[model samples]
Target: MDGSRTAALLGVVLLVTACGQPAREPGPTGCAGGVPSCAPSTAPPSTAPTTPAPSRPVTVLRGTVQAGVEAGCLVLATDRGRFLLLGGDPTVLREGAEVVVEGATRPGQATTCQEGTPFSVSAARAEPATTR
Candidate 1:
């Protein structure tokens, strides 16, 4: 075939191949999503929906009320762990006494309290020794 005809045939072939392929849209950067890729995609943006704050109480730890010897505050020690009492009557809730206390956690509750997470005691009850 002539040079011009051959060039025309090649141009048509290239155009047909390009038309057969699907078009793709640019995708978001992978670094922000940690996907490790930036390949072109037609999909929508990936995102996590915003969540609301919880309405209920944070914690309700069960432990025996112990005297805060080092910190001079009240402390509750249970199998879970130990926590310093923020506001509660330490008179009846004496050391070695089993009690169930419920309250929300207080971050940086008291500087003097030691060896326990700061916990605000909202409701508390002394249990019978027989239950132990």
Candidate 2:
């Protein structure tokens, strides 16, 4: 066959293949009555959903300061149990005396908890202060 005839045949084949393929349409929209003729989309909406873990409560730990770790953490042991109090001012807490420290008990190491250490309230009185 001549080059022109072969070229024409190839063009026809290409056109047929292109025409056979279905064209993709835009997603449906939820526009109101009798306006743009758009319908609600069957496909689900895309969202960056997140499930945040429940927040831990602020625990008041009353114990003797066991030992001090880095970043103002005192290992405390009370009647309840031993827990690493997130942050404690060294001057306020002593080695043997009883202490009541209020802070959040985070999941991991106490060292990192300093930043998120909820609200710390401490009281160190040898005897309950009485008014004269």
Candidate 3:
């Protein structure tokens, strides 16, 4: 064959050889292609925003019971703050007796009795004074 024809044939063979070769690197996608078991599925990233849950109210309290500002109810005095306890026997709670008052609390029961947040007492226990 003439020199031009031989060169053209050689160029075509090189192009075909390059086209038939497999890709050596997986790149950013991270998975191999065409060996179906080897390639990880390509899925679009999730766009949903994350959010925190709302906080809940307190349900338990331990403190000393004191007389309400008026009468007919009682107040719990802890180191944290005072709270008005309802729904349990107020007689068991003396002015200085330590007690465990269990209930939910909310702002503004709008009572003439106490100046603290109102708590509904589900159960009560008078913790005895330590002798020491």
Which of the numbered candidates is closest to the native, going by highest lDDT? 3
The TM-scores, one per candidate, come to 0.50, 0.39, 0.50
Backbone clashes counted, model 3: 0
- Per-model C-alpha lDDT, please? 0.72, 0.57, 0.74
In order of TM-score, best first, we have 3, 1, 2
Each prediction's total of clashing residue pairs, residues at least 3 apart in sequence or on different chains, is 0, 0, 0
Selected candidate, larger TM-score, 1 vs 2: 1
Q: Order the candidates by lDDT, highest first — what do you get?
A: 3, 1, 2
Candidate 1 lDDT over 30-102, as tens digits, reads: 3222222445556776677978987657577777887786746778887878888777666546788788787
RMSD of each: 12.3, 11.6, 16.4
lDDT of 1: 0.72
lDDT of 2 at 64: 71
Residue by residue across 1-132, what tens digits does model 2's lDDT show? Answer: 999999999888866765675543554553433233445467766787878997667666666766544545456666876665544665666566567777665545435433332334443333222459
